[model samples]
Target: MLTLTENASTIVKTLAAQAPGSDDTGLRISSTNEEHTAFSVGVADAPEPMDLVVESEGARVFLEPGAAVALDDKVLDATLDDRGSVSFAIGLAE
Candidate 1:
């Protein structure tokens, strides 16, 4: 399960809109053990393995099984800065 904020909502829309033609596109949020700390956006030629499709008010998030583990019980969100740009964050429940 996951939650989407307004800022995340906007980013989701932008990514979807960026897809080629009318092709369906959405956000894929994952947690990796690799030493990388950033989100990614791209077009997939086909469905990915162990991917969970999440949707909220026209926004979507694709999560891999392994990544979902770290995201479990965590609130996935996106927030806007003073510059009006958006960024993503995850919060674990206390």
Candidate 2:
């Protein structure tokens, strides 16, 4: 299963909380291509029926099948730039 770093967990929680509807809203990741080398991220009110739900440290991430497989042994991390922009990255889990 994919894991979230502390930075990623905090950032995801903040961003997801901004959505107006469900408290279960979370960050969603999906593969951009068949190779699963690229991913797109967004806030979703709920996971798709087939999505894999990953929760850590109060944060939740929904992953499509390809993305879930691709990221299975990875870690999600984030950083907030000086201008308030957030960037997300993936790394191998040790």
Candidate 3:
């Protein structure tokens, strides 16, 4: 149930396209700790078999099972810098 802002969606699409991946390319978020507070971000060719796929505005996000539950009510936002770098942030959904 994670929602993505327009900016986030655009950035995700761009990143996925730039990576060597198939049409299902997307941002993959996975928890690194037991508490699920910290996460690793990367572009993946496709979701894992157990991943929760979230899509918006043609943008795709694959979340690990734990990450999906932790972010179930969260919103994703992103900002692109002048240097062509992207940063993603998460927050509680309104």
Ranking by lDDT: 2, 3, 1
Alpha-carbon deviation at 86 in model 1, angstroms: 3.6
Kindly provide the TM-score of model 1 when superposed on the true structure, using C-alpha atoms: 0.69
Off by over 4 Å in 1: 21-23, 34-47, 80-85
Model 1: residue 69 alpha-carbon error in angstroms: 1.8
1-94, model 1: which lDDT tens digit per residue? Answer: 6667666777777767777644447777655555334445443422367887767778767776656655656666677779966677777655
Q: Can you give the lDDT of residue 5 in candidate 2? A: 98
Query: Can you write out model 2's per-residue Cα lDDT over 5-75, one digit (the tens) per residue?
Result: 99999999999988886988999999999999999999999999999999999999999999999999999
Would you list the clashing residue pairs of candidate 1?
none
| Position 41, candidate 1: lDDT | 40
The regions of model 3 sitting more than 4 angstroms off are: none
What lDDT score belongs to each candidate, Candidate 1 first?
0.65, 0.97, 0.95
Point to the candidate with the largest lDDT.
Answer: 2
TM-score of 3: 0.97
Total backbone collisions, model 2: 0
